[model samples]
Structure formats: structure tokens, C-alpha cells
Target: MSTYKAPLADIRFALYDVLGAEALFARLGFADASRDIVDAVLDEGARFNETVLAPLNRIGDEVGCVYDKTSGDVTTPPGFKQAYAQYVDGGWAGLTSPIEFGGQGMPHAAGVPLKEMIDAANLAWGNFPLLSHGATEALLHHGEAWQQEVFLKALVDGRWTGTMCLTEPHCGTDLGLLKTRATPNADGSHAVNGTKIFITAGEHDFTDNIVHLVLARLPDAPAGSKGISLFIVPKFKVGKDGVVGERNGVRCGAIEHKMGIHGSATCVINFDDAQGWLIGEPNKGLAAMFTMMNTARLAVGLQGLGLADRAYQNALRYARERLQGRSLSGPKQPDKPADPIIVHPDVRRMLLTQKALTEGGRLLGYHAATLVDVVGHGADEQERQQADALLGFVTPIVKACLTEWGVECTYHALQCFGGHGYIAEHGMEQLARDARITTLYEGTTGIQALDLMGRKVMQLQGAGLRVFLGMIEAFCKEQEGNEALHEFVAPLRAKAGEWQQLTISIGQRAVANADEVGAAAYDYLFYSGYVALAYWWARSVAAAETSSQSDAFKAAKRETARFYFARILPRTQAHAAAIGSGAASLMSMDVTHFGG
Candidate 1:
């Protein structure tokens, strides 16, 4: 059996049962997005992912991507262009784009789950289109009127693709040291020059043109990140009549040999005075670029969750079918040559861990996606602001925690397959390798932790934290008598309380000691992530209790929740202790200490 299925029931449960996605859609006046429409969309998305995309998984990994310097073009694995053509023909590329831009205008919540399914089926293939979505988001928010009119339609229709060019050899996380430059031309345009490395989908054959949203410093601008500006640099320049024009100065210097996601092209692009148009106001490029980064970060978290889900599905299938030693209680399958591995307690433990985390991650991702919709279309300004603030707080947590656990979950899933897990045939190893990049790209886990603690929490004066805690507290109050769910909620509340106190303590300490914040940041972010997942699980359990208690559905929910609290939730204690210990230990370690 393949590791790809619709997971339709679970998706429905999360969307309608737990997250109230249906009501939110109706309340937001998205009248066309009814339950039937949503289900149909999901079903079609699943079918495409399972059938059209899943076949490319192994082939893409094996063939990877090839760059021909002489031709200045990157070739995708066999059948990728055909698959992408089908994807575009079906209008999947514009599923959530604005209606004015020739898109379906569906809510992000609807589109994101579809994205997860595709990513789970084949992460490497999914990344190209995923990056395009990020670029589209940046353009929609920050692009000028003419720029939007000229580019948004083609982008939304998938006639063109997009990429974000920010990272350089000297600057990855530290954009302040970025050396790319944009010099003003006689006309309103600018001449972009410099090289950008680690650019995903930087150059590809998937579309007619590639729109690059590049970050560069203008001449006579101030030093550091403050002087940077965003520009639209198309691979093939667009003329006044919207026709493809001459090739711009940009060229792919080389492609990197990476650990994973080899199917997605990561190129070193050299921009030698390329014609470019500035995006947004001068010196506000960071803000515009962040529009893409924040979206990409969440998408990366979804990538992590998708990989975990796929790994778990594959592992579960293997466990149930692979015969091994007899059951602990004696031969229930005595008639057979051997019992299946699923009969063993340890195998069950690993499977349960994967299920709990993947399901929990899905719930969290869908919840966050709903918040994006709320922030975009909510009735009240305060509601939108609150959603924005809370989302900002959880963004780093979602990215860091999900990606980290995704790698762990995939590893455990591989372990379930024994020797076969390591083999490329089963595709388990590929899942783990592909998952590794989710943590590294978007932002490393350490960078995410710093963003959470230093920017989201400390700089915002804990406004986001208070909003999140208040919501959790209100939920606890509402469900005080919910015995079915209180078992999950009570522990969650206590853990969340500990987390809040820990945050307060750390925040206080960091004021007097900058090192203290850095030291505790990662641990604090992780602890908070656990707390967040626990809250999601609790809500899921409560929703399950209120639903018609079909034995299979209710039993799975309860079992998954039990597995989470018993095995997964306990790790937060370690994170809390580590955070409480402060930065002194980390700072005091001498260089010689590592030599031993």
C-alpha cells in the first residue's frame, strides 16, 4: 500500500468538528464555500496528490534536479513538467488567490490542507509550487498597482512562477550584511546586481517566466538592513503589451548538492545589473519581505506535519502486514507462520507516538490556518488584530516545534520498519531526509526560538502571550465540567500555567541579562509548543466527546489523546527545567571543554 491517502475523515473532523471552519466561512460571507464545496475541493486535491504527484516521489529523489551552465536552465525530473501542467490546468495553483487576480478566492484554511496532502505525497515536487505561493503573497500585499496587474494574473494562473531571493553566501539569517544592490535607472525601474544563494525555485522550466522578489540595497542608501528595498526582477522581462521580452541579466551560477529535497532546485543566482521595479516604499523592504517569510514559515511547518503523516501511514501499514515474533500474550496467530509486528507492545508504542504527534500537528496547523482567515476577513478590527497577534506568537512555535518533532517522528517511523526502513525501496529514509530541510530552511530552529522569545514575546510586551493564555483560560472555564475532556484539559492547564510562569521568569531575567534570553529561548519556545499542542489535543478530545460516539472514531480520539499525554506531553518538563536553568551553563562552557 502507498503512504498516501486522503485522510478525509480526519480533515473533516478537524475543520468542522474542532475548528468550526464551516461557521467561520459562513460568518465571513464566503457563501460559495459551503460544506459540499469544501469536501469536493478536498477530494479532488487528494486525488491529484495521490495519483498525479505520488508517483514522482522516488523518481524525483533519484533523478533530482540538473543545471546546465551552458544552457542556463535547470531541468526537473522526468514527468514533473507534465504533472505541473495538469496541476495548473486544474486551477489548483490559484485555489486561494484573490478573485480579482483570476483566482478561486477560497480561504487559506481550505487551501492549506490541500497543500499538506500534496507535500506529504511528494515534498520535493511540492516545494516549487509552494515557493510560488509565498511570492504571490508578498506581491499581493506589497506590490504596486501596475506590478500586480501585470504579474498577479499570470502567477495566479500558473503561467508564471515566483521565488524569494534573500539569502546570500555571507548572510543567511543576518540580512543586515546582505550585499546585493539595486541602482536606480533613468526610468522608474532599477538595475539589480549581486548574487543570491540557496534560492529555491530560483530558475526552473515549470513556467513561461519566473518572477523574483529580490531584496537589495539601493545606492546612497543607509547601511545595514534598514536600507534594503524589495524589487520585482522577472527572469524574462515583461513588455508593455504583457509579452515576454529579452532575458534579464540574472543567471544561475550553480546548483548546490544538498542533503535532501534534491528534486527542488536550490540555485546560486547572479544578478548583473538586471532591470527591476521596486516593491513597496523605500527602506520598507524588510517589512514586505517578511510578508513572504511569515507565510513560508507556516508552510514549512505544514511540510513537517505532512512528512510525519506520510511516514506514520507507511510505518503503520508495514507494522500491520510484516510478520514477526508471536504476541506477548501467546499465539493469537498461532495458525500463521508468525504474528504481525503490530501485535508487539513496542511497535504499538512507536505507532501511537507517530499518530499522536501527526494528528496533533495537523490540528495545530489547521487552527493556525483558520487564524489567517480570521485575520484577513474577520468582522471586527479588534478580532483581526487579536488573531494577528496570537498567530504571530505561535508562528515560530509552529515552525520550530513541528519541524523538530517531524524529524523525530519520521525517524521513529523508520525504526518501526527495522532494516527495511533504511532501504530506499520503502521510502521511509527519504521522508526523514526531506523532513530535515523543514527545520533548516524558512529559519533554523534556533532562529525561530529567538523570534518567539525576543520578538514575539519580549518585544511585544507579551501581548500575544496574554491573548493566547486568555483564550486557553476561557476554554478551560467553559469546559470545567466536561469530564470526558477535563482529563486532557486539567493537565494541559497546569502545564500551560507552568509555561506562563516560566516565560515570565525568563522575561524578567532577560531584561538584566541578554545572554539569559538567548540561553533560555530555545527551551522556552519548545515548552510553549508542547503546551500549545496539548491545548489542541484537549480541544480535539472535547469535540470528539460531543460528536456521535461511533466506537472507531471516539476510541481513536481517546487513544491518541492518551498516547500524547502519557508519552509526548512529559517532554515539556525537561524543556521547562532546561529553560529555568538559565544561560550561565551554556555561556560558561570553555572551548577546551568540547575537546574532551
Candidate 2:
């Protein structure tokens, strides 16, 4: 079975050495959380994921979740319940949750790396707790007093799990056409009646109770998204004493048979007059849900990074162990039957590409996490606001770019294993399949592009763009003295400048012509994603250069940075050119032009 060892040293280097996460943590009033505490948490997280959760990945995928229609009960794969119990016992579920609700209240920076470790170990098992964390975030942000007291504690403590109920059969992205309805009862509660499809962790036996943060429309509400309201609909009703009471009106109608992540129970939830309490204000559910949606989007990006890391590790190990053809120049190991695959230039290329992207993604992911912490707990309001604006602008890029790169990285990793990759035993196929969804869900790549070009960039009038460019410029200025980093830094700055010009041009055309935005949106998003990754890689290279001369780690960092610039970063050129080419060619062709 494939197992994961958390990249502790790399994480420390990124957090303390590169990003200055420790200083930021202290400044943000997280003074109690020192380096020792962080190390202990990470160590515990690594052990738990490797020993308890990682081993069950394949088992869960094989057995999956079974639902008995007559009994209305869901049984998880073997050992899942025990593993979940262990997860709760270790307090892994509340690593970043608020202390007021029985949580540890650790900073987001601390939580994110731990999340990556678990996700890399087992994407399927990792999902069960992930959804719950998202739900807790939503509830804490939008849930009312009574609702928080009842549901938040259970969720934070991992005694209960949660799922977001969106994406109906007829409507997925277009929530304006959704048919779910919530009717107000004589009591203070509302009766929710709707069918929510593609609900991850919708039905499971991992926890005693399941809390659903659902989106539905009130009976007398206005039409479209404006009418939508958020609700806390639980599987089992909670009594005043904080115990599970009667079975609620919610139940799993059916479970989705998916291509990957089979261990996660994706359900068609039937809410037949399920008693629920209102969260936030009526007709503002969409806005409220965006809070959870945005967090989920970032988490989804980490999912991509995690899978790519695992794929790279597995492939790297295989390359070192599986002897293949002799060296093209000459045999280095003359006594052996064949040289290790890692000795080949092409194999090295593939592994280096994976290393560059995955490592770069880890740094970027941690940066985003720290941004969230700064936004929430920064020393000053101005700093908080800046962090908020920057994070809001980059969330789409982080989600779309990282996941897209993740799938590409996984593909290369699988190819490294050759025929063994196609087989189930190797687990490469599963990693690829699991990664495929990250780009599709939490808003598709096209949707993210539209959000970036249409909403974030064009709408902000370069405010957010200016912030990003300013940061890049400052970094370049700081590294100007470093000879080794100059090569990577200069190209990154040029790419950023080119992308900025392209973005402005696209915005200009999009304003005059609505159709142009649609045509240029996808390419523009890809360009932005590429440029953002390049910036991250450049900074990583600079940090890696500062390490002690005797340490070979700096060499690894430089090699990965070189790989990124030579192989991966060049793709942005094509994406930018496509964005600048306008929307006519793609939209001009008729439906019957080439197809029957």
C-alpha cells in the first residue's frame, strides 16, 4: 500500500525561513503557539495519517459506502468508524477551529500543512473530515447563537460531521434555476424540502450525527438567487440538553457511483420537511454560502497539491528501485543488470517537473493559509483588510491553477511508472482519477477564469492586481543582490508585466463587447495561474539560495526552480497570446460547421 511521510523539514523551511510564518503568527497574537507546539502538532498529524488513515484508503475505495434502502442506514467501509474515532480523539478535526466552540483555535497556517499531509496520504479518507471543517467555517461565520451552541461544538469536536447541500440535479452552477424550497412553520423553525445531489459525505456512519448547511428558497421569497436562504438541517435533531433526539426529515435518497474517491459518500439527499433553522438573513444565502464556498475552493486546491505530491513521491521511489535500461553514455553501475530509471535524462526531467510544481504549490498553499490568518487576526485593521483583498483576488487562481497543475503533474508521475501505472496495485491510476475532480468542482476552471477576469480584475479596476504586482516588485528588489536568483526573478517579472498588459487589454475589449469576455476568460485565467506559479517559484528559488553551502537542499530547490522556468512557466506565453487574440474564432463557428 502507498504511504505518506509528511515533508516536515520542507514545511519548516517554507514556514519559518521563506514566508516568516512564525514571526507573523506571533504578531497576530498567536504567541502561545511557538515552534515547539507547531512541531508537535505536525508530528502527531503525520503519525495519525500514516498509521490510522492512509492504510484504509484502498480498503475504503474497494468496499466503499453501502446504503440499505429499507433500513435507511449507511455503513462505511471497514475500519472507517474506528479511524474516525481516532481522528476525533486526537483532536485533529478542530486544529483550526475557534476555542469558544470546543476547538483548539490554531492558526490557519498551522492547519493547512496538516491538511495537506492527510490529503496526500489518502484523498478519499481525507474528504470525510474536510467537508466537516468547511461546514464549521460556514456555521461560525453565518450561523446564529442557538445554532452555534448546538451544532458547532459537535462539529468542532468531530462527534458530528457536516456536508454542504448544493448542486441539484437540474442546476449545478446555475443556482438561479434551483428548485429547493424551505417553508416557514408556525414555530421558529422552517421545513426544508429539496433534493441535493453530489453532496460529499452526505450520508455516513463515521459520526453520531450529521449537520447539513443547505441552500434553499423560502415559500414567499423572490425568484432566482436573490430568494435563496441558508439553513442548518441536521440528520438527527438535537434536544435542549445537547443530545441527539428524534430522526429528522432528512435522509439519503441515493449515493452517487463515481469514477474516483469512492470512499467518500456522495449522496442525493432528500429533505422532506426537514426541520431547520435559518442562518444569516433571508434572500442573502448566496452571499453567506460564498464564505464556505471560498474556503472549500482553497481546500480543493490543496487537494490537488496533495495528490501531486503523493504521485511524485511514489514515482520517484519507483524510479530509484525499478532498474531499466543502461545509461545512454555508459553504465555507471557496471556490476548491476541495469541502471535505475532515475539515471535517465528524460526520467529526471519528468521527476524534476513534478518536484518543481508540487514544491512550489506547497509554498503557495501555505502563503494563502497565512493570508487567511492575517485577514482574521492581523495586528492592524489595514493589514487585515489588505490580506482580505489579496486573498479574495487570488482564491480563484489558487484553486484553478494549482488543481490544473496537479492533474498535469499526476499524469507525468503516472507516465514515469510506465505500464505499472495502468494497474490498480500501483495506485497511480487512482491518484490521477481522484485529482480529475479538483479542476471540475468548487467551480470549474472556466468559472474561475471568469471570476478572475470578469469579477476580480475588471471589476476591481486594477486594485487587487496592483497589490499582487507590488509584492512581486518588492521581492525582485530584495533579491536583486542575489546572483543565483536573478535569472529566475527577471523572467518572472517580465511574465508578470506581460500578463498585466494582456489583462488590461482583455478588460478593455470585454467592456466594449460582452462576448469578448466569454471568449478570452479561459485563456486569461490560465495565464494568470501560470504567472502566479512563476512568482511563487522565483521566491522559492531565492529562499533556497540562502541556505548553507554544505546543505544539498539548496541545490534541489535551484534545480526545481530551473525546471519550472524552462518547462512549466513557458506555457503562459501561449495562454496570454490566446487571451489577446480575441473571442471571434471560438464563437464564430456554427454548431453544424464540423459535426453532424
Q: Any idea what lDDT model 2 has?
A: 0.85
Task: Please provide, for model 2 over 426-518, each residue's C-alpha lDDT reduced to its tens digit, 9 standing for 90 to 100.
Answer: 888888888898898879998998888778877777566778888999998888887877888899889878877887787788777888888
lDDT of 1 at 407: 97
Q: What would the per-residue lDDT of candidate 1 be over residues 1-596, giving only the tens digit for each residue?
A: 24688688888898899998899999987887899999999999999998989888888899999999897799999989999999999999999998999999899999888988988988988888888898899989988777888887889999999999999999999998999999998878899999999999998889878999899998887998899999999998875357778999989999999888888999999999898989999878999899999999999999999888888888999998899999989986889999999999999988998888888889888888888999999999999999999999989988988899899889989999999988888888888899999999989999999999899988998878889899789889989987777688789889878878898899889888899888988888888888888888888888887876477898899888988898889988898889878888898888898985
Question: What TM-score would each prediction reach against the true structure?
Answer: 0.98, 0.97
lDDT of each: 0.89, 0.85
What is the alpha-carbon lDDT for the whole of candidate 1? 0.89
lDDT of 2 at 499: 72
Every model's Cα RMSD, please?
A: 1.3, 1.4
The per-residue C-alpha lDDT of model 2 at residue 73 equals 73
TM-score of 2: 0.97
Best by TM-score: 1
